[model samples]
Target: MKTNKLILIFCLIFSVHSFAQPKMEEKKEQIRALKVGFITNELKLTADEATKFWPLYNAYDDKQFELRHQKMKAFKGRMEADLDKMSEKEAAALLAQMESNEDELYQIRKKFVTSLKGILPSVKIIKLKKAEDDFNKKLLEQYRNKGPRR
Candidate 1:
């Protein structure tokens, strides 16, 4: 009877986790849609410009997302390590790895902006950056105002 209860508990936990994963992905999709609309409106993209812009922008966004995921994973691993017991050499290496990740993120941004120069006016590209910042700020403000999730 005890073994059966343990099995049931494990199954329940697994099912809940599976359900939660889809909901998390759904929320990500919704936010992505909202960002697209926000950016489109902010840029005042013409149909021709949007046709040329979104593909390049989406590719750049995907690369940035992947790099951020890698950086966060590395950060989490470092957090889990016993820093007090770590050697100077190991700590230096981790610091170097963190710096390298940041440099790579910067390089990707530089390349994306350079590519945008060919597709957009400098003024519009600057506006794109502002729009991105504004969207992020608004999203953060909304999240903060909502308070902590239960």
Candidate 2:
């Protein structure tokens, strides 16, 4: 039918326009790739250190990602709730969940630091922290320089 054809045309245009936008997932992967290279260079990782470091680093990242994904799924709707209209019970629950997530995030970082201690020198680990902070700062700066998307 003509209506069906019109609908298909609309979908095609919409898909094309949406595709032009910078996707968040792609941006994240790009940053992640850059971080790998940045950290490798910053640490001046030798073959031996890189070999031992990457596997442990990857495991820690995976755990952290899992925890974050879990929190997103659990709190996605709750996070967007209106504060003033939210019941005390709902607010308390959301706060408790947020607190729990923060605690878990901190614990994972502590565990990651402990694991890194076995693989990297303390100096390299310190450099790694600085490198991470620098990478984030640079990423933020780039976003700011780009200004808001229309």
Candidate 3:
């Protein structure tokens, strides 16, 4: 009887996890749609400009996301370790990894902006940066205001 109960509980938990995965993906898609709309409005991109711009922007965004995901994965592992007990060499290595990640991110941004110059005006590129910042701030504010999740 106990074995059956354990198996039933496991199946229930697994089913709920499977269901939740789709919801999480749906949420990501919603946010991506919102970001696309926000950026399109802010840039006021001409149809021709948008045709050229989106491909470049999407590529850059993907690269940035990939790098950030890698960095976060590594950081998460380090975080699980006992920080106070970490050796000096490990601490130094962590700092070096962080600085290298920051530098790589900066280089990526520089390359992206340089590429943008061909498709967009300098002023519009500057506006794009500000628009990105504004969008992030607004999203964060909304998330904070939403209160605790279940």
Candidate 4:
């Protein structure tokens, strides 16, 4: 009887812990959508710009997406593992990878901005930068208000 009670307790605890953790794929999708929102707001793109921008944007996004996946693939299952348990070396390595990924993103943005400038007005370029900043600020506010993922 005591053994059965212990098993039940264990199962209950496991169930609660599982429910408490946010699913990785769900978080990825949410972030992806948020990024899309930023892109839209930042561009404040007109109908004509939208027609031109989207195709190019899609290509750029795809490239960035590939880079992210490539970086993540390097770490494999270790990302899901507990951060607290990671060794200093592991953590440092991860940070370096993150920095490299960030640099790549910056380069991609620079290239795309040049592309946009060729087809867009200087005024629109300023608006696009402002829009991007505003979108990021909003996302930060929302995330902070909501607290950490469940």
Off by over 4 Å in 2: 1-24, 148-150
Which pairs clash in model 3? none
**Candidates 1 and 2, the one with greater TM-score:** 1
Clashes of 3: 0
Model 4, C-alpha of 57: deviation from truth (Å): 1.9
Better of 2 and 4 by lDDT: 2
lDDT of 2 by residue, 2-60 (tens): 43344445544554454356887765555565667667777888778889998888788
User: On residues 1-150, what C-alpha lDDT tens digit does candidate 1 reach at each position?
Assistant: 343344445544554344345477766655666677677777877777788999999999999999899677978788688989989998898888889888998999999999999888999999999999998997787669866566
CA displacement after TM-score superposition, residue 133 of candidate 2 (Å): 0.6
Using all chains and alpha carbons, the TM-scores for the candidates as numbered come to: 0.81, 0.76, 0.82, 0.52
TM-score of 4: 0.52
| Decreasing lDDT order of the candidates | 3, 1, 2, 4
Task: Give the alpha-carbon lDDT of every model.
Answer: 0.79, 0.77, 0.79, 0.70
Q: How are the candidates ranked when ordered by TM-score, highest leading? A: 3, 1, 2, 4
Best prediction by TM-score: 3
**Model 1, residue 49: C-alpha shift (Å):** 1.0
Error of 4 at 17 (Å): 24
